[model samples]
Target: MPQSLFSRMVLILLGGLILVQSISVVFHLRERDRLLFRSNSMESAQRIADTLRLLNSLPPADRHKFVAALNSPTLRISLVTPPSSQPRQSPDGANQAASFGMMLRDLLGENPPIAVTVSEMEWPARQHEVNAPYRAESIHPRQKTAFTVETHLQDGTTVSLDALPTGQAFPLPPRLLLNLLILLAAVIVLSLLAVRLATRPLNTLASAAEKLGNDINSPPLLETGPTEVRRAAHAFNTMQSRLASYIQERTRILAAMSHDLKTPITRLRLRAELLEDDELRVKFAKDLEEMESMVAATLDFMRGVDNPEPLQPMDIMALLESLQADAAEIGHEVRLQGIAAQPYPCKPTALKRCLSNLIDNAIKYGKSATVIVNDDDKQLQIHILDHGQGIPEAELERVFEPFYRLENSRSRDTGGTGLGLGIARNIAQMHGGELVLKNKAGGGLEVILTLPKPITSGSMATKTGAASNIQAKKPRM
Candidate 1:
């Protein structure tokens, strides 16, 4: 039921330890009961047989005095007249009596007639007197075992002994539970340490995997610890190497192809310029220009995949202001809102290109673009919204595919290569961020760019020590 491996392992180990402890306690109690009962029965039977033999050897007048000598705290000896009939006993009491009587007969032979009866009795609570007839050590606390043994001697004198001995039930060792608790606590501590050590490698591997997504050039995992964990780390490092090599090779090939195609495109453009019919010349120039644009866009897309830009902390507001000024110069309206609390870690050029493409799309399809920034310790979000007809629901995700576009948006009149959204998304992913599109309620499209902040050693300290501005900035109209 536990979600974490550490918690699950501790629960299983603790459960098994408790179960084994319970079984051991039960078995110990049973064994203690058997040993105590045997010793107590044997001692009681031997004392009674010896008392009867001593009375028979002495004269009747002196027998009573000697009986007082045989008395003890556990056993009381006295003289009694023989009973007319045997006393009735419950089945369990009768069985105990029979067993005790047989033990007496085996010790004393058949000469003396002996009768034994066992009955359960409770000790009075008020017997706390220090000088009572029986010592506190000789009496049981709650239920006590009461037994009466009678023997008829050779001269018809009857001797009776009543025993209310202690140790009828084995007293529990006072430190049993305390010792078990201590053992359990120690074992639990050891189990936690072992489980944490065992799961540490898994945590490292997961962190390495996440880091790998952010930067293909990130360092490989260290191959240490157990054999299985070492093997997994080695495999992950190998896979990362292969992926990086493949991307580099693909980028080199695309770069060569783009270079090879540019020469032909230049020649075609020059030849078209020398044509006699102006209309035919314009059409040929347009076709050649479109082809050249497609080839350049494809190369850009490929380069975005394997961009080698390093991350650095940069002012987000300054970048947005630069973009706003550029759009203003081009006669396209762009508004900026909100403030970043701190410099965000990012590949500056790649992130700028990503935002530029998104803002351009908004300006092209929608009338104008408004960029809103929301920043925190965990992540930075920039939302670019527009004021034109929004994309259809079915084509929202499909528009991100390379060279794919809506019927109205990707026409030749619009002068687009249809790879802008794909290139933007690729750049966002390379920075360990995401770009998402959604239709706004008031009519237009909204592009959300989410960039996660990298966690560094001093980040937490800085966050705790620095004062943050929570008030939002108003958008420029």
Candidate 2:
């Protein structure tokens, strides 16, 4: 299934938006987590430090009251002083000062009045060692109080502080992920709605274009959408109105000219009947014939000015075969080659006339014609070959102008009204096809007709038939 431009545009816009939003959400969550963890950790560490400072300010007799007030199953605190003469090694056979120095630096000032140390242990062991190895000594300047505080909290956690605080493990909240999922779903739904809203006007414009081609008098499209879309719709409506007016003016002018010519042509035909000299009469008749041909061609051209032929599925091969057969019956050496067995959707009658004109011209000048059809998936091409005197490169395009014959002489004996090629080109263009004339390699003219492949039901049916035929004709034992 082929998608229209509007549909493709909508899908692309929504897809790009979704991708950007997803990336933004991920980055946002990561940043939020970083900020949240940093704030939480800072707050927890500050609360612990403040409590220790308050405990230190108390009088010696009121110290027990301070500790009792601070007592909680979720938190514990213990104090340590410097070792006297002999220092007891920590249970892990490591110097406590070295192990706790880094944590002390982090919690307190990097250089404190009293040096501090900190360590970590499991809840049970941390409680058991709270009061062991109590010692007193002076390690700080001017008899400052130096203390070691150990705290055991619920959930099998302990914090041993000589100076600084150790960081805790923190995990992202599950609710954050759930919220992100909800945001993503909402963004997808909203994006789809936005795409639909943006493309609605484009869809209306497409339908209006089809209707306008079918009938110029069709109502203008409703313009409702964003600013850009409304402006575009307005411009399209204005262009259509101008085109209709131009076509009407041209039609009126052609009608008046055609009406005026009829009387003069009729009088001339009547006057020719009474001529005495047969030679003179024949010349007059020839002149009348040329005039009649010109008038008919002009009328056909004028009629096609506004009203183009309707499109339909046409079997190009069958059309070409019929043309070849007709030309052959008239003793013209015409051949058909490389014809596609499939039917293409086009204006059959208009295409038939266009081909006939080319073939007729070939037979007239070269006395032979060849018609070939070739189809690739992209396009359908029809080539008409002739052995006629090829046109000069400069004059190739000029030949398609009405009444612009290559031959300088205006004599009817040359057998051309100079309108055949012009009419053929007009018919081709009406069907969204092009007629191109080029010099053949072997000194003849080649006319190429190129048209877009059609995507209609009738054309599809024809393609199906062609496929079936090819399958049946496949080589077998």
Candidate 3:
């Protein structure tokens, strides 16, 4: 999954999503804490300012009695004897304390001089050195502190407002964090699905191209997906159509020409029969017969190469033995060795015809051939070893060209149209395999027909092209 383009894209997108989500979570929590804490501070400032206003409204004698009335669990207003020079800041060292002080001053008005000091009860003025080590961000919304306000009244009595839990602090809500996590997961899953959808067409197109190489008749790619994908598919289909048409047309022309030539050669043979000169008549008839046979063989070769056979499952062992028996019957020395151990899907007739051609070449030249099949998971290697005087290394590939016999090495009678190897190679390639030629270690030629196993669901093309090794003298034909 990770190797696929779609999977890689999904992983990349998921990484970015995770990074963005992490950043969002951090920012959201920090912002939530800030907003909540600021709100708590403003509330604290309001309560303090209201207490001071009530004290100012009360007469000096009534201030002490009203002080107890203003006292609550969150706030305490007491009459201190005298004002102090310094007051403690809140234990929570956040700037909210200063902000609260400014807000309080704004509400109280400038006409009366009001001094506000919010100090941490946990770390009091004289105990700053001792409790400073414990100063940390409070998890709670309520600030834990002592708010002591000391200012002289007109009668010299100091009124103080002390609030407990004076610090302002807030943490992100658990519910909000949970919702963010759920949303992140949902988006990530959806992103993966979208990436898969986008890349699916590319995989299909690639698979179709591979199939097309093995079988030009492979089904056309489905011309549907995004607009860009559809356009590419349409072009691919058009190319396939042109290629298929071109191959069929060429095969048809070869067949037509062969048929037309044979008719003329047949008429010539009849005319030769009516000749009075026996020797000349015999020569003309012989030439005409050769011409007719050559045309027929050439037509057969073309048909074999361009066969439109579909792949079918067949046992390699059975095919090899069958070919061996056929060759032996014809006085050809063909030996069989090692089984394929399993059946593989292929164009049975094409593969059989290909093997027959190679074996025939081996018997014709080397006088004997050895067929050996060896296979692994990915490919089947069928080696045909011949003991003939192998062609020179430079001319090995040239021998497989149609009508390209080495007259010096190959007798005209035996090298039938010189299209056997060429046709065999075409058949092998149609099955997605290849033909390879190599000189045997000792003497003669070794032909390796490397056929691919089914890639997954169906037969693959075989090697694009073998001959055997034997120590026997050439056939006395």
Please name the candidate that would achieve the greatest TM-score relative to the true structure: 1
Structure candidate 1, residue pairs in collision: none
Q: Evaluate all candidate structures by whole-model CA lDDT and list the values in order.
A: 0.78, 0.63, 0.72
Ranked by lDDT, the better of candidates 1 and 2 is 1
lDDT of 1 at 434: 90
lDDT per residue as tens, model 2, 9-64: 65776678778978987998777755554444454355456665565566556756
Task: For candidate 1, write residues 61-105 as lDDT tens digits.
Answer: 998788776665557788877566766789867877888888889
Q: Which stretches of candidate 1 lie over 4 Å from their true place?
A: 25-119, 122-126, 130-143, 146-162, 167-176, 409-413, 457-477
Q: Say which candidate scores most in lDDT.
A: 1
lDDT score for residue 377 of model 1 = 72
Q: Rank the candidates by TM-score, best first.
A: 1, 3, 2
Please provide TM-scores, in order, for all candidate models, with all chains considered together. Answer: 0.78, 0.60, 0.64
